[model samples]
Target: MPSSVCIMEDPPVDRLTSPILKKYYPCPNASPGYFSLRHKFRSLFQLPRIHASELPVQQNKPVSPADALTAAAESLQKKVVQNKSLISEVEIQQFLSSETGSDRLKRMYTKDVDGFQSPELWFIGQSLLKICGMTFLITSYIGGKHGGEKFAKENQATAFRTQFQASRLRNDHVVLAGMKSGFIWTYRVGIFSSIFLFLSQSIAVYRNKSSVMEYVIASGVTGSLLKANLGPKGMMSGGVFGSLMGLVGGTLIYGFMLMTNETQEQRHYWNIQKYLEVQRELNKGGD
Candidate 1:
């Protein structure tokens, strides 16, 4: 009878209601909160990031025409409006008063026939000298007399000449050939220089540098060293490459020197010029 009574009393069920059990039991239903908020919190702590190798990578989506147009419009608007950050009034006045700044500003705004010609002629002369210098240095180091003789022979064979019968008959063919060889070599040097300038322009943009001067210097130095390593046969090829680099470096240095004296007006002009270029690029993409 005692056993039956004890069983019926629920065997001290209140003992199961101890604070420790009660605390763990019921597990207060964790109200499933915002999944996105939880995910964000996880990300913030870098706690549950999926490994890159765990999932298939999705390819980058191509930018749509509408997105491109919107980007261009934004750029154009940003540029057209005066951005005081790019050019301030105090800086402009200072640049305008400076000799170098004045000259650069003039060149940008007004057409000066002489201004363009002077610089062009100077560059041409420099290129010619560079070609001659490289040819001498490389040949002297390698084949010595033999290399000189070979160059002469090649020049004589390949030199430019008049197509007219009368000119071809002249006894001065050798002299004309030599002159043509010089001209051809000069033209090659010029071409290499132009290529360097174009490449460095892209580099400057990529680096977000205010000046392309550093690229120019680095290219020339690298090209010279590389050419020197190639021996005598590389004279023509290496010289052209080196000259191109030199021109770029020289131009960068020169431009920076001038930019040092830039005033408020000069800054404003350059800012506008940069924006216009951005607009042109945007237009190209739209088309």
Candidate 2:
């Protein structure tokens, strides 16, 4: 009998439809070129392809109940294999860098961030946030207490305006006297612009739709303006930039008063007169 003819062909793919087969899904010893290809081959039989965002994405392989226990055991074995110092620098650093997967993840994140903030400060902030709904306490005090929640809060904005004026006058006196005490003293050079930006933010919060957004925008403006006022070195290193910042600050703050509506007391006094006239007419009608 004649030997049977052997036919071999390259496996057909969606992109390449060829009867001639050069290789299977992956050639033996083929470089793990793309991560996608490596992962694809690893779970090619286990995972299902799903259409997502117009891309063919592989969904997670379904794990059997037995597989879950097996995985958990493997995880425990991995934990055992990891080397851990009895006591570590991690403890001194206020965090644990252990064999624990969660700790490792946290350590990685902290490393990437380059030690963002102090734990002590974080605790203090948490305590204050819980004690008072003061998300922007630092901001409130910096503006000479002329703006923020006190002034433009709860439709009692008139109260805020009066308080703000009083605060500005106090700061003006401080600046004129060269009285450097507290934040006012420390940031005295830019105090003028400080007041102005405060008033602007306050007005925006009270009159505009979103107070938070106004302040967020204000913060960016304030930082730039503050830098201009202080310059590279700062107040004692007072340059032309510092002088300009102070001038701008003063103009903005007092100008806001000139631009806005009348004080609450003045408006109330006018309304009272109208009320008295109405009362007199009602009494006359009864008579």
Q: TM per model? A: 0.27, 0.17
Model 1 CA deviation exceeding 4 Å by range: 1-171, 210-213, 216-218, 221-252, 259-287
Candidate 1, residues 1-287, lDDT tens digits: the string is: 33222111111234444565334333343222433345456557665668879999889989999999999999977885744334445654554445353344344344333334223234445765676667545443443344355545655666455546433433245444445565555555545555554444334333424354545554664465457657765755765676575666667665774678543234445644554455556665678
Report lDDT (CA) for all predictions: 0.50, 0.42
lDDT by residue (1-287, candidate 2, tens digit) is: 22232222222233232322222333333232443464456565676766678786789998999999999999977875562222233332332122343433232233222345323234334554443333233433545344333333434424445767866755565343332233343343244334434544344323422223333344445545556666655533343444455456545644564557433223323433433444545665667
What is the Å distance of residue 253 in model 1 from its true position?
2.9
The residue pairs that clash in candidate 2, if any, are: 9-21, 10-20, 10-21, 151-160, 180-185, 192-249, 193-249
Total clashes in model 1, counting residue pairs 3 or more apart in sequence or in different chains? 8
Candidate 1 overall Cα lDDT vs. reference?
0.50
**In angstroms, how far off is 224's CA in candidate 2?**
0.6
Q: In the order shown, what is each candidate's alpha-carbon RMSD?
A: 22.7, 29.9
